[model samples]
Target: MNEIKAMEKPIKFSDPLFVTLVASICCLLWGSAYPFIKLGYSAFDILAEDIPSKFVFAGYRFILAGLLLLFLFRVMSKRKFNLSGKQFSSLILLGVFQTGLQYMFFYVGVANTTGVKGSIMNATTTFFSVVLAHFLYKNDKLSKNKVVGCLLGFIGVVIVNFHSNLLEFSFSLSGEGFVIIAALIFSITAIYAKHLTGSIDVLVITGISLFVGGLALTILGLLLGGRVTHFTLESTGILIYLVLLSSAAFCLWNLLLKYNKVGKVSVYNFLIPVFGALLSALFLGETIMELKNLIALLFVSIGIYMVNRVSSRKFSNTLES
Candidate 1:
């Protein structure tokens, strides 16, 4: 009760420093998920071809994460879990787009493409979020700085994926194509979530949506004969890490969005791909020390700086005016 009251008190959610810290943490946690998920796959002996198994595995992680969050929040806030009919409906929509459909496409798309390519492709979510926010909200109109920052981030993604014959003019609808679709879904749902936060608790919204989406995935996976080869201590630890990541990342992200403009906060998403690629290299023993990687990081860093600098100036001007 005390803690909840303290949180409700004035805080620096709009301050550039606070937003950068929280949003960067959220993106980094999500970025680390790439390596952790890969480790989970290996630990469980889940083959890349076993798409159903991937779904089941993701389902368990998310469901457990959601439950853990709900329990923690209930205890901390000294409140019982309750939801209105409208909140429930909003959560269902969020689950459908943010988790169920997004992951369905992402898992399948990743299975068909190289991990490097997939990570780069997933960064498209940043672009989607910015564009969607511009159209969806009266206050979050598109700006030249936003466009330039996003373009630089996109260019960084491409640079990171640079290699001979990287864009060999061939496309698969279910592979790379589906990954882009997942990005679009995530972006749209993020905007929806921003709206929902106006009426519901952030923790409630995140936990319920995760649980609902995970349940849906679990049912689909079971019907498709998904199964893990092992449930050993190591694999269990990996699963726990994933659960923690999902809980922390989603919760923090929701809170951030609740208090901040989508475009300003969403641009940090570009860093996810940079972190994913670097972490994957560390954990999977893939190559990381490349000229392109360094250049990509530089570009991404600049993009983040540009986006936030413009946003902060606007905020400062608002205060003065």
Candidate 2:
């Protein structure tokens, strides 16, 4: 007589190491975005003999990125280029909210503020995501750990801003306000994306959304007379880098979301400000006020830890169920 053997289910999510690697790559790509934007702005300023409007620059870059994404989608997937009615509508909405409006706010914010400051402000996306997710998704309950994490992250944001204030506070309130708006948009996008996870391929959705978003920006740019008068090597490089890295990271980020819990993947956003500050210091020679920056990093780290802990508990519960 032979004994019966029970078979184990295969893991639905990617392995821990792979998820970590992808997340790190996404962070690094996103972290470098500020410096690249600064470089592009500098080049634009050089050519224009004055600051090129942020909206103008961002509008062009996003359109280019969107086109590139569509091209890549066609090459890689070889799927039909047509969109269904539902997909078309969803992509249009996503494009407007995520790519078009979000970047409009972010570029304007960065134009008004220093790259380092913009990066620090961008960290608020994580906190806002928690709030948005709580309200948007019935399954996404606000647990104690998540609440603590959000509070800790908010503290870090305050510390980072406080340090900036100590250093003369010359920053524009409008700029900071734009960053906050951008964060809110991103949070909304993340929460909305959670609903789309099972319905479409991440790359497909990203490409379509970007293409549509880019087209809208292009139209707006044309209306505003934001013509590309000239392009330099630096501007070209920045555009290319932004398009490639952003597209790649967007794809990977979506993949991570599909495989992992939202809270777990979102913890990575906590690293954005911390890494962005350090990278800004290293590359752009921005001042890194040691005490405050360290405190902010600590808060962000604790927040991330809480997010992870809560996510793990939730995952375990699902497994048991």
Candidate 3:
């Protein structure tokens, strides 16, 4: 009984070690999203022109995720779904941009590009978040080490693409362009989410935004003639996994950002592509032992180490000063 109560205790945000454990779990779950989404595309038979269907699929995933989160929170904490008008409006806005626009762009973008290229491109979210944080928070200003670290991470992403014909420069605005745009959107909204979570419960914000955004996506997809096929037991099971990851990853990520520096937390995003590539190979039966993939992983790991070193030094200096 005492062990159960102890396990249920709240996370200690001030403890950097605990924050890293929680945040890393969130990133790992999100990293798995890349391959799972590709599998979803296959299961649902979502083709390139089936953009609307993608939206519908995402809608189902997130709506259920949101509802599940609400139900779990209610059961665990006995909290109600009470919210003021302002909170409701804020969540609506967060939902529109964060889950709605971000995933809308992501699904479409991934459809048009190779999985390798798409995963690498999507990593720009870290850079975007770091830059945006510098401007948004006085304490989170970009340092020389941060710039070096970000550049190294970006270079790692670029290196991974060298195995392909990246110089073809045939980047479609709707495809790779949308992926980049989605990263920007994610970065911006993450900052806003952190700010909002300062006042509102992370669970409330996550649930409301996911539900509102998901509902909108579902309506828009159906209106645009989008349909989901292959509603078999297997596909339903896959979808349930998606819902689980969405709820768990987003909720935990929001809490991490709320408690820590955005730049410090966001740098771990460099690992997503590494994980994505590895997982894609594992699940999708693609090649995994390529030299480029290993090299890319090394570069990304170093970048993560560099960024954290600087961030840790900064934190220690602040304490001393």
Candidate 4:
């Protein structure tokens, strides 16, 4: 019995690494989205409107992505599409916070700010998740290691943002505030999603969330006087790319979260800014200013190490207390 238990332990621990790899790939795909969005906005600006709006781009992409996921879900599962009253309400709330509000603020923020800045801002999702999980989910308690990790990660965020041309410490506050709020919304989504694991199939949950969120965005777009007539071939291509990649990433991410600790999975978000900056530089020819960028990379790397290291029995016991 003792020998069998010892053998089982290794498999149990190894399982999480596969999930982590999948989640990391998802983050990489999401990180690629920054440059595509930049290009799409530029193309739309030339062909459609003067303001270079993200509303039109985000609205179309999400709606299309949601519809695609719905079709896929129907084909793959013969299970009846039913939700309990409680589950239904939770799905609606998840849609509002996770998909609708989060994307809206993100799109608006990205539209106003540079891609590099936007990517760095999104890193706050992990830090905020640590804080939110401490208060919101009793199952996950904060330890000294987590506290130290978050502080280090946040310092990296500050360094990255400090290097951005868009960062103005003066009296004028504009897009930066919006982006920060967007990051907070993402954190809220992570915390809120902990309640959803056993209630619904992850694909179903993702489909419903996307569908409702897409509808909300469509309505908000109309209310804000955003016209649908601006869709062009270039914008359409960009929209397709965003939808496909985002849907794939979203599905994979939810699947991963089921098998791994949320903090462990979320550590991949730190890689986004790194990949985003590098991709922007390579494809978009965006220049990297050295000093602050190096410092940001160093801190982000350290944070990832701190967050991912598996604590031994002693550390686990200390964390539980």
Candidate 5:
């Protein structure tokens, strides 16, 4: 038995190189979203002021993503998805918060802000998670590094709100403010989803919540006089890409979490905004070379690095204690 076990290969998911590649891919996919979503908006001819139509577009993306993920799970795992009344109710609440309300803020925020600024602002999600975790878990209490990290992260966020002259300060609630709100919601969603995972498969939770949330957005948008009839090959292709990316990225991220420590894998998250900024510059013609943008990016990156610098020894000790 020992010999046979020794002959078996270890799971690639836990291997360092494999993890790095997958984690980087996941972040890259997520980062591409910042630019692609803006492109999506332009393709569909959705105006910046059209809130209801944005809802419609976001709803469709999540709805199809959820359905596709569910189908893939069924085929790949061959596991039947079963939900109890309580589970169903919980999923509905999650959908409302995680998908419906969160995306509402995100889409609105992205639409109103430059993708470069919006992406950098969204990095606050990690800081929010760190702060929230400190309050919830004794083992996850804040350290000096965590506090400093958070301050740096916030400084980055604040810096981005300033003009090139450093004197004129302009911040939009519909843009950066809303993105920060969405980031906070995502922090909360991460905690809530972790709790729910004890009872349900992570995939199922994500799939159902996304579907229900999308349905809510679609219905709400229609109720609020939103219509999306402008569908071209480009628009349709972009929409499909959005759906596929959402499904693939979320599921892959969860899969990584399943096999690795959150600290080790999550450190790669800083790359998301980096990718977002660069890609936004590449695709949306937005520039991140401005003094404020560069400084903000540097601060945010350093802050995130500080926050997620937990060594394996520390993580293991925390779990044991």
Candidate 6:
């Protein structure tokens, strides 16, 4: 408590430096999840076709992540769970869509698609987030740059996935289509989370929602005859890493969304695919450092710049005007 009392000041989560550093770290961690999930399948001896096991695996990761986060905040931050009936229901709704259904579709979808295609489809979350924010938030309405930025980032995602024939692009209802649906669900629930954070502690919101969603997934998976049978040292280690990453990433991301314009923060989501592709290459022995990848990186960087660059200049003009 003494250490907590000596805290200097509230962090300026809106500061460009803080936002850039934290948001990038969150995206990088999320990007790493792509390869880690795939590795988890191999390590656990779960075949790609084993959908129920995939659900069980993800359920355990998030259940543990949620508990870890809840304990940390309760102990260190002295956070409480004095939620109203409405607030409690709101959190349950957020968890069901955000953590439970999103991962249910995402795990199955990614398993059936190529890594490149999965990453590309995941980028659609940003698109959905930005567009939804425009309609939902008065302050985060559509802007010229926001549209252009999204398109550029989307183009980059497409480019990175263009490994060979343009005709190679194909979509399956259970594969890429499921990924798109997951992305949409995530975007919609994230905006709802931002709304909840206006009244509730963002960390508490993240923790409770994750655990609630994970519980649902676990129960459903078990009922469907899903079992996590193999628990080797390596697979257990991977699961632990996933839990830690999800806890940290989701906590930080919720804080950012609570403080920043949803569109501004969501635009950085483009980097997930870039980091995903690069990390997948490094860990999975896929191609890397190609000309197209560099081009895609350039496009993505430029898109992020366009969305954020307007803010710095606007701040300056406000001072001078």
Please name the candidate that would achieve the greatest TM-score relative to the true structure. Answer: 1
Tally clashing residue pairs in candidate 5.
0
- Superposed by TM-score, candidate 3 places the C-alpha of residue 247 at a distance from the truth, in angstroms, of 0.6
Residue 182 local lDDT, model 5: 97
Q: Write the per-residue lDDT of candidate 1 for residues 39-114, one digit (tens) a residue.
A: 9999999988999999999999889988888887798887986788877888988986788889999999988887
Per-model CA lDDT versus the true structure: 0.85, 0.69, 0.81, 0.67, 0.74, 0.85
C-alpha positional error of residue 126 in candidate 3 after TM-score superposition, expressed in Å = 1.2
Model 3, C-alpha of 293: deviation from truth (Å): 2.1
User: What lDDT does candidate 3 reach at residue 183?
Assistant: 95
Off by over 4 Å in 5: 1-23, 109-121, 151-167, 170-177, 256-269, 285-304, 313-321
- Estimated TM-score per prediction? 0.95, 0.81, 0.90, 0.80, 0.79, 0.92
Tens digit of per-residue lDDT, candidate 5, span 1-321: 242223222355555556668777888888898779778889999887788988998899989999987786676667688889999899899989988999889878977886556766777776777777778766667778677767776676556555453343458999889999998998787677767766776677778888888998998888999877789999999999989888878766665655554444555666676666667777888776778668867886687567556644454465479
Candidate 2, residues 122-178, lDDT tens digits: the string is: 777876777766776676667888878877976776675564444656557568779
Ranking of all candidate structures by their TM-score, best first: 1, 6, 3, 2, 4, 5
lDDT of 1 at 263: 91
For TM-score, candidate 2 versus 5, the one ahead is: 2
Residue-wise C-alpha lDDT for candidate 6, range 1-321, written one tens digit per residue: 343333212346766667888899998999899899989999988787888878888889989999997887688777577899999999999988899999888888988787668878889999999889988888888889988988998998888878664458588989999999999999999888988987887667888889988888888888888888799899999999999999999988988888788888998899888888888888889888878878988998889888888775765575578
Task: Note the residue pairs that clash in candidate 5.
Answer: none
Show the lowest summed lDDT stretch of 10 residues, model 2. 1-10
User: Sort by lDDT, best first: what order?
Assistant: 6, 1, 3, 5, 2, 4
- The per-prediction tally of clashing pairs is 0, 0, 0, 0, 0, 0
